[model samples]
Target: MSRVVFTLALAASGLLAQAPTPGPLVRLYPVALDANGQPVTDLTADDFKIVDQTKPQTILAFHKPRNEPAAPHEVLEFSNRTSGVTPHATVILFDMINLLDADRLANWKALDKALPQLESGESVYFYVLNLEGALLPIHAISPPAAGDKTWPQGVATGFDKVMKASSHIRQAQIGAEEQVKRTFKALEDLANKLAAFPGRRDILWVANGLTTVPDPMLPHCNGDWVECSLYVPHLGVTLAKDRVAVDPYALVGNISPDVNYNMDQMALLTGGHFYSRQDVRAVVNQVTQGAVGGYSIFYDPGPDNWNNKWHRVHVTCERKGVKLQLRERYYALPDSRPAVERMKAVLMEAFQNPTDLAEIGVRTKISPLPDGKPGVHLDIRIDPSDLLLREQGGKYSGALYCLVSDRSATAPLGEPSVLDLKPELTAEQYKMVMKNGLPFMQDHPTSDTAREVRVIILDQNTNAVGSVTFSVK
Candidate 1:
């Protein structure tokens, strides 16, 4: 069988058979900064007051956001690092899709001068959104090899080649209204990739102007420019779901304040700042500050609060002149069938997609089964903290849905096999789980011809995902 679904008849694991519990407790990551824009490192849970729909809710828990590297995992291991609560990442998207010729030149020349000066190993990323509205990576999210040029050096030396190649791939210009739609779509897709990773994600959206994102709808809104953007609430929810903050930076100097009101609103709505004018170095500085130096606070929105509406969220800090940035709004509606269908689509896509998602950190071990069947035994350990657990009665309850695909089977696959992991933990069990990791062990039958096995795991509460692909030895 070529490309069959891996059966998840889990080998009698303790928690795999339990019924899944209802999800509770929403989490938010908000950035706290001083008047001079420096991070406030010492803020505690008592220092914050979270409001939902004009009602003040008590802060249940909070943690200062930091990049804590994980302890070593097993060999041949792949980790998404969701469990460690990795520090924020910054993506610098040079928006050639919207910039004019003159502005594009000025934008890149500034980049050419400032890129090489970035500290050698900062977590800042670089990409170019081409005229076709397709995203191309200028610098991948990996360390450079020894004796190899860094991305900054590469950009400084060969910036023209990058720009030319991106332009050469352009098709017929997508119309103004379509440009707006596509731009938002591309941004949402980008956010989904970052969703699997925890902590804040800062996107430095570099464009001189993006007035076309809603060209057709703009004329109908009278003078309430931001009202149209508000109705397009899915974009805001997607950013918030992924814990992403958008920092809109002007591509060229002296941009008129009236040019891109929507982006400025986006910056505020997502807890990121809008840059009116800045050189290349300043852009890096702003993005780094926005990403790493921040805080993550979680609050219980009460049982009656999830009433499927667009709820406004605001955070207030007790310290004077300490500005707070967070996603101000989110749609409370949780889709029914679409979510299941979406994960299935993603599982199918994982076989060919180059990158594996890390929002839900996952580590797995594969070994040969001792039985006569020519299959492999799978052992999975997930970062327990990444699961959305709620304490009810005397137990902590949460669940995970796992999907696996294998092309190396003898029979054609049927509807995908879903593995449900609803762990039931008492106080002692929960403590043990926190000390060790969450484990899911199963024996999966594989064909001798099996080449690769792809697994996708997701938290049912938030739909945060992590995936890994391992070769059959």
Candidate 2:
């Protein structure tokens, strides 16, 4: 589903005000290993230092190895609150866009052989990038049943069928340029979806390799006629020299430099690793083993210049004989859109994969109104402490954005609502808000045919999102 509803309740309401753009808060997932290449789990924040562009940055938050249990398949309902709290998720992406037919088959066989070795509490999702550029989820195998330790037999069979079908479809489509574009876009989308999860995320990209640049013949032409010869004819102009012919099949067998750069960036930003041309068995083994534990470090790069430049980050340990792996850089400029507008964009993206985000906690109740109106009463409660609020001029200020939608009709029930909280309260009142939580109640018209209701909530101050889906009964 492309859209999900988000609901938020704040203590106070006022006109929405634009806050100054703050520097990006960069979160890194660093893996420390000993000489034997075993994961090192004993390191603390004081033992490490982060340097950005040669400037030292103070670590804002540090989390130790967080290894939580994976949600079971039987309890994996998308419309429930508890199902959203996945601590770790691993996506095994089979890149059909960049792999040869022989390599694809070999990798598939290798993954098939290694599937049974997955550990308990490991949440693994299998996705394939087809020729049409869709990142299709072929199968998901959560922790097996209580007594059963092996991968589910039915799930494995379903995966095989889906993979075969996807491969056939991808093989029939022509043109490498389109494939490259689609693959990169899919990777970016996946990264955004995973941003909502507050745990370790590993993307095991199994492919031949990636290119950093698309085919020169199919260069991205953004209004420059010289660069986009395809537009020359439409512009009533022709080149004196013979026009450079575009061989659609020329990029069919080769990777580009741009693709390589894009893939590497996605892996680093999301605290995941990238692999290419590796044995499927070895890749699977590494992913399964590496999923055990990792450290998350948050740092705020103070006062961005908005120069829109890439800043390199170097993290090192004070202790000797330990190697660290983490993302190297992040952009300095913030999203130019207003915070509320950005929140809406984030909400739309989160709707594509609602379960990926579980930062904010919420409870929702829906009941038919006793007045016999053709509508349902919606009550939503949000923990105030979960929101990132700032105290300004003796008042606590925060912002919230909420949306409710009908999944079947693919339309919003009403215009999105924004709550700008600026409550001037005594210390006792503030404490009460923290303890009792923010509660909001509203009644909205509904249709009998609408069987599902999706709600999405966003804390504009923090950009943390919480989403829930409920059956209309």
Candidate 3:
């Protein structure tokens, strides 16, 4: 029988079962600094007030100067040292469908310079917001260099195609307004991706600024594009059909003369800054400071989410002489779904389309082969573990699949293998096995001691969802 069939049979026989309790909430603090390049480390809880809408709320946990590295226990075995709470992971947001030639080059130069200095812990992901949909990673690149020489050339080509396509559509007026709406809708999709990630993530959004399509028949009197670009796109349009006009200037307004106003607003709320000038180094510096200075604060609103709405946050300096400016606010909506459901959403995104996952977990266990060759088995674990799909009724029905990837430069120890996890196994169980049961290469006796190995998981037959990386030395 095929592996999928075999796994399913195993599940039916009750060989696997779910685990109790959900995973712990992973929280990281992001600090945002101002122009003077000072870290806002002295604020107290009372000095900062969180407001969901206009009402006041409590602050659950707060930390200042939260740039310290996670405790050793908190660090992943494969974690990069530089990956701590430092504003190291940089996201390059390029809007091909909406950006002009000048804007495009400006973005490229900034990314090129920024990609190199990323510490081992620091990560970089590139995205392009256009009508083709939110452009996720076409390929994953590791540190030392996130892109090959040819990668930039390829990205430039994609940008050209999107621009060309936009020009073609701009020429057709049968739905001129509609076409623009679709394009902005694509940008909003990009926003959703950003919001889903941990708050205070750094994103360099390079675009022509945000524009709201005109409509004057809605309460709160805001335009649809702003809501879509700011909150949720579909809901934004449904409630904003008669709200506003497409005024790009008002949407982003002076943050970055070049970036879309709506896009900039979203970035600001997420604790990221916008850049428009072409001074590549300067822009990079700004992004670095923005990411480093901003911090993410999380709190539980006492479970009284009776009327789900957006909650606002305001941070003030407790010290008398210091001035505090934070990304204006965040919407506190009720997340009724269990953490597992949320994990699944992220897994689907990482493993399927929109490769936004910045980190993955891989567990390995080591054993000796009959011939005394060191053999290692690895399991890559991801949250919302249901992604590892199993076959049912002769069709693919599982959500996740595991594959072993070999990056070994030398020797023939053995090829990697994919582990077909039984569907009945819970995500937590998968994680435990992957985390603690993974083989340790040191315990294995192998002639080929110099090789790199990775356990990679896939979702929907696309994108690498989770990966465990190690080298046999």
Candidate 4:
């Protein structure tokens, strides 16, 4: 049996320079804003205070946006993208579930003016939530065509079609409670779907329901204006998992004190900004800017902090007049530990949807093993510069967890092979790998079958994943 081998400049160090797979730590994402409502990216670790369950926790790691040069070395055969930048999208989700006809007309007028003003180089999608909480795509979500500048015309065309058909369809006469339930369900479904996208997406939720109506599914019965209306309690956590921000833009006639309060909660809970008194184009630009300039906070809450209850998380900047947008609460009891179970889920998701992941730059080649043994050789080329590495005590360290498997074969190569490599290197070795990417080699015993063979890799530190799937005949 052949074991996996990594070829790189990893010197033998006694200080445990090879990073160990760390336990799950709390990761807080905060989007800071200036007094004029713009993303603030220059703040450092000392500028903020984070309190969990009313107790201050020491900041273990602070990660700014990955501003490194995305270009790979000229010697590498393949990298993440040839475009030299990560692709993002703007999703405009309009809620037509309970909109009055007059309000719809007003939105149409505003959007008509805003559509021509919308400027973007990334993907953009437009959809509507129908009466039954099903998404009706006005313009389906897709990556922008290379060198295609006519997308704005396509958006105008799609909107024109929806406008012509709007007069014929009547709004469903549903109860307030049912409408609220449907709105919550729509948001849940949308978040799950958006997880497949590549980078962080900004959702322009042009809705009249989620903010204007109080949640009916919340178990408590206190009828206070803003405090009583919890949007089903679990909605915030669900949105946070998908790496998408929910920027709520209320319709013209739906603005109320209760509506504004609920809208603020939706934005705060999902690390998004409320687009009040703004046009569609301006809102998209600001939200996109925030996504580009957000910062991530990592703090290790010891095992004793898991009290199996919901804990409130408060992040405030020491600099006055600066506002921070972040998730307000986190459940103490996560679904599973990250060592085995969470790693398994990450592998499965990557293998199942290999094309959707590209954070870690990787390329692969498969062929018959040279040892005259009945096995196939698998070689993976990894770009080390894309990984999140930590430098401590004159050494650089990073961890990688990988899986290689084929789900279709039962007679052979059915069982998934899991490999974890945590490499620690001296400063010289780190410089060598940075100049020339790292190479990985492995082999799998298999029979003659043409099936989907997938190799999934996960960067343990940042949870960045990449995969490659090919058929072996």
The parts of candidate 2 lying over 4 Å away from their true place are 1-14, 18-49, 58-85, 96-106, 116-123, 127-201, 208-270, 274-304, 316-325, 331-334, 347-356, 365-386, 391-398, 402-411, 422-455
Error of 2 at 355 (Å): 6.1
Per-model root-mean-square deviation over C-alphas: 6.2, 10.6, 11.8, 6.3
Q: What digit string (tens of lDDT, one per residue) describes model 2 on residues 1-473?
A: 12222343221232333433233456666778778767777788898899988989887556566343333323223323353332455556667776777567766666665565555323556677776677776554232322243443334576678677877773556555455456556655554444444445555666665433322566654522222332222111111010111101111233466555545554454344555544544554555444344665666676553354445678899879887766565445555775545555566755655342444556667778787987667777665645655566766656565556554544434333343333344566668777655667666566766656666667665555677666665
lDDT of 3 by residue, 179-295 (tens): 456555654444444433321434455556444454433346443343333334443332122111111211121345334456555543444444444454345455555444554
lDDT of 2 at 109: 66
Cα distance off (Å), candidate 3, residue 90? 3.7
TM-scores vs. true structure, each candidate: 0.71, 0.58, 0.50, 0.77
Off by over 4 Å in 4: 1-24, 32-48, 72-76, 81-86, 142-149, 163-167, 209-231, 303-310, 317-323, 331-333, 336-339, 359-393, 404-417, 431-455, 461-464, 468-473
On residues 1-473, what C-alpha lDDT tens digit does candidate 4 reach at each position?
12243212212322122335455667777877888877676788898898988889877667555444565434323344444444456677877774555687787667756766677535677777765566777766654342343455557677767666755666667777677677777777777767776656667888654533454554574643233454544665577677777888874676777667767777766677777657677777777666556676777777777665556788889988788877776656555563544544565677666253766666676777777776567777776755767899999887787777664532224456657777788999888887766667888765545365667778776566776556665
Give one clash count per candidate, in the order shown. 9, 18, 48, 0
lDDT of 3 at 142: 37
Winner on TM-score (2 vs 4): 4
Candidate 4 at 43: error in angstroms?
Answer: 5.3
Q: What is the lDDT of residue 67 in candidate 2?
A: 43
- If ranked by TM-score, best first, what sequence of candidates would result? 4, 1, 2, 3
Q: lDDT, candidate 4, residue 410? A: 29
Q: In order, what lDDT does every prediction score? A: 0.65, 0.54, 0.41, 0.65
